[model samples]
Target: MRYSVSEWTKSGSPWVWLNAGAVAICVIMVVGLLGLIAMRGLAHFWPADVMQATYTQGDQSRRIMGELVQQEMVPAEQLRGAGIQVPDGVEEMRRDLLKVGNRDFSSADFVWAMDQGISDKTLPEMIMVAERLEWGNFYGYLREVRESGETVARHDGHAKSPEYLAVWDEFQRRIDRVLEIRDQILTIEKHEIGSINYELERLRLEERSLELEQSTDAEAYAEIEARRAELNADYEVLQQDLIDLYTKINRDSFTAEIADGREVEIDIAKVVRAFLPNKMGTGEKMAHYGVKLWEFLSDEPREANTEGGIFPAIFGTVMMVILMSVLVTPFGVIAAVYLREYATQGFITRLIRIAVNNLAGVPSIVYGVFGLGFFVYFLGGSIDDLFFPEAKPAPTFGTGGLMWASITLALLTVPVVIVATEEGLARIPRSVREGSLALGATKFETLMKVVLPMASPAMMTGVILAIARAAGEVAPLMLVGVVKLAPSLPLDGNYPFLHLDQKFMHLGFHIYDVGFQSPNVEAARPLVYATAFLLVVVIALLNFSAIAIRNHLREKYKALEM
Candidate 1:
C-alpha cells in the first residue's frame, strides 16, 4: 500500500525545495528591513544641499528656500483628492517634500510642493543652514553680522567678498568663545551651585532632626548659619559670573534674509552650527557629516525631544540592563540550583516549574503594576521611612526609580534564567555528582567548584536572554524609572555616586515619545529612526558581549563536562 521509492523521492524533493525557498525569502526580507532602517537613520546627519525655488499654486506665488528632502510620484487623482487642481490629460504628478526650517517664522517645518507648482528651482551657493538650539533649523541667506548695535560685517550679496569672509571668521571665533563660556556656566550652575544646594538641604534636615530631638543649642544653630552664609556668598559669586558670561555670549548677532525677503536677526549664541551646505565640496560635507554625527551621539536633547542627542537614554538603558543582570543572575541561579540539586523530584516541584514558566508569559504591564504597588509603594515606602525619613513627603524611594525598574525587569526575566540553568544542571552526568561525594567532597563544594563552573555557559545564556528581554522593555519602564527627559543621570558626581532612587531615560521610551507624542512630528521622525537603530545596536552589543564570554566559558569547561 506504501508509495514507490521514486514517487516518494519526487514528493520529498519538492517539499525540501519549498522549505529552502521559504527560508531564503525570509532572510531577504529581514536584510531588506534592517537596510532600510539603517539608511533612513544614518541619513539624518548628512549635510543636505539647500534649494531656492519659486513655488506657485493657483494665484499665489512665493519664493521658498530649504533642503529638498524627498521626491515622489503619485496619481493625478490623489492630488485632486487633496483639493489641488490637475492640468488636463495629466494622469500622474511629481511632488517634493522640502524641509523648510525656520520654525519660528514658518507655520510648518516641512511642506509638500507639487512639480506643477514649483518653478526656477536652483541650488543656491550662498544659502545658509543654521542648526539652532531652540527653533529647529533656520534656512536663509546670510546678510550681515552685528556687535553691540553696530554692523561688524555685511555680506553685500557676495560670496567671495573679503568682508564676508572676515565676518564668517569672526563669527566662528565668537562661536568657539561662546561655547567655552557656556560650558563654564553649566559647570558652575549644575555642579558648583548644585553641591551648595545639596549641602544646604542636608543642613536644613540636620536642623530639623535636632529640633525633633529637642536639642535647640544656640551654638549649633550659629555654626550652621555661618556655613550657610559662606555657601550663599560662593553661590552669589558664581551667579554673577554666569550673568557676565551670558552678556558676553549675547554680544554678537547675525542677520539672515529669509525666504519671504524679510531680514531676521539671530543671536550667535543661539546657533549650534551654521554652514552653507550648497557651497560645500565633498571634503567639507564629509567633515560636516562627521561633526553632526558626533553631536547627535554626544549632546543632550532639545526642542521637545526633536533635536540633539540621546546620550542620557543610551546610558540609562545600558545601566539598567547591567543592574538587572547583576541582580537576576545570583537569585535565578540559586533558585535553579535549589530546585534541581536539592529539592525532592515530585509533583509539587513540577508544578512550581510550570508556575515559573507561566510567569514568563504573563504580560509585562502586569509586572509594572505589581512593581508600582509592591516595590515602589510598599517596600520603597518602608525603606524611605527607615533610612531617608528626613526627605519625607518628597518621596525619595517611594516613587518610580532606577532600583525598582531594574528589580522589576529582573523579576520579569528570572524565569528564563531559572529554566535555562535547570536544563544545564540536568545535562551534567549523575556520576559526576556522586563521584565528588564518594571523594569526600561536600555537596556544596562539588556544586560550586565543579558543577557551577561547568554550568557557567548555560548561566551566561540565561543572562544573555534576560538582557535581550530587559533592554527593549518599555511598557514596564514607563511605570518604573523611564521618563521622556530625565533632568540628570542616576549616576553622577553627587554623594553615593550611584543614585538608585533617581529617575532615568530609556531609548525605547525616547523613540515612543518622539514618534508618537512629539509636537513637531516632522522634526522628530528622523530622530525616531536614529534612536531605534541605536537601541538595536545597543542590545546587539550587550548580547554579543555576553555570548563571547559564554563561548569562552563553554570552551573552558567542555572537557570537564564531557
Candidate 2:
C-alpha cells in the first residue's frame, strides 16, 4: 500500500491498467460505430409518418407531401446564399429534407423545405405511398382503381368512404396477383429459359469447336443442330408464357393525386408495395418493417441500386471469399512448411521471409493492379487463347471475373497465412519433433501426424485473418471482377453449377457505388449505412465460423501442446 512510484512501475500495474484501458476504449469505439450504423441503416425499413403541408416560398405556394427524412438548423446567411429568403430578424432557419417521391412527376425525389414556410402540417390516413419497380416511390392520394381501362372503383377527394375501402381491397388483391405473376415470370426467364439459353450457347460453342478442329463428322453437326432446334422450341414456349404473364400483370392500373394535384395513371405491375403509413398501427408498422427489411435483403436492387435488395452483392461477396479461402490455404501452408521445416535457414531464406513480410505491407490497390495485369490479362488471356479460341473477341477468361477476383485476393492475403503458419511452426517444441523421429517416425510422418495437427489451429487463425481482409477488400475486386450490377449470379443451376468466369456484385463495391456514385444521394445514404452494417455482419459470421474451427482444433491439440 505504501509502494513508491518506482515500485509501482516495477510491479507493472500501471502498464496493465494502461493496456486494459486501451482495450476498453477500442471496444467502446467499435460498439459505438456498429450502433450508429445499425441505427441509421436498419431504421430505413421502418414506416415513418408521412406529412402533408402547404409550402410557401416568396409569393408562390404549393402542396408538399413526403416522409420527413432529416432536419437541421442552418444559419440565415447560408439560406440567403442559397437564394432562400429569410426574415431579417431570423438568425437561423430549420431546413427539413423530405423524401417526396413521385420521381416521375417531380424533378427531385428529395427536397429541402424551409420549416418557417411550412403550414397546416398533417398526417392524412388516406395518403398512400406506392413503392414502385421504377422511378422510385409514388406518394399520393389513391383516386381510382381500373381494370383493363375500365373503372372498377373510385374515391372522391381524400375520403375513406365505402367505395374507397372497396377500391383499396381490390388494389391489394390485384397487387398480390401481380406479384405471383412476377415470380412466375422471373422463374421462367431466369431459370427455365436461362438454362435453355445456356445450353444453346454450349451447343453453338461445340459446333464452333468442331469447325476449329476441322472435324468432318456429319453426325456431330446434325446432333448439334438437333439440340439447337430443341432449345429454340423450348425458348419459344417460355417466351409465350412470359408474354401472357406480362399482359396479366399489366392489366390493372390505379390513379393517384400527387402533391402537385395531378392525377397520374400507374400500372399495377410497376407497384411493388403500397401502404398507408399514417393509418398503420404499431403491429402493422412492425410487420411492414419486417417485410421491407426482408425485401432489402432478398430482392434484387432496382433504381440504380438505391432501392431493392442486395442479395446479389451478398452472394458474390460470400462466394468470392470462399473461393479465396480455398485457394490460399494450401499454398500458404505448403510455403510455411517448406520454410520452417525443410529449407535451409540461410541468407536466401531470410530474404524470402523479408519479401513475404514486405508483400503484406504492399498497398492493396497495388495488388489489384497486379491482379488485373497478371491474373486477369496474362494468365487468363493465355488460357482463353489456348482453350477458348472459338469465343475470341469476347475476351472470356481474359476479363475480370469471379475466379480472377478470388485468385487476386488469395495472393493479396497469402502473406498473412504464411507468416501465421511459420509462427505456429516455430512455436512447436523441437523435442516433440525429435520424440516423433525417435519413435520410428520419418520427418514427413512426424510433421504430418503430429506437427501439422498441432499447427492446424494456427493455420485456421491465418485463414480467419485472410477472410477478414479479403471480405472487406473493394479496390482489387473492382479491378478484377466486382461490378455495379451483375446480370446473373456466378453460381446458378447451370451445367457447371458454378461459373467462375462470370462477373459478380460485391457488398464493399456496392456500398462505394451507392454512397458516392448514386445520382440520388439522399435516397442512397441510408442504404449505404445498411449495406456497410450487413458487410460487417457478414465478415463477423465468416470470422466466427473460422474461429469455431480454430477453437475446436486448439482444444483437440491441447494435450499435444502440453
TM-score of each: 0.96, 0.98
lDDT of 2 by residue, 6-118 (tens): 99999999999999999999999999999999999999999999999999988999999999999999999998899998888999989899999988997998999889899
Q: After superposition, how far is residue 501 of candidate 1 from its true place, in Å?
A: 0.3
lDDT of each: 0.90, 0.94
Ten residues in sequence with the least summed lDDT for candidate 2 = 156-165
Give a tens-digit lDDT track for model 1, residues 68-122.
7889999989988999999889999999999999989989889999977889988
Query: How well does model 2 score by local distance difference test?
Result: 0.94
Decoy 1 TM-score against native: 0.96
State the weakest 10-residue window (summed lDDT) of model 1.
156-165
Candidate 2 collision pairs:
none
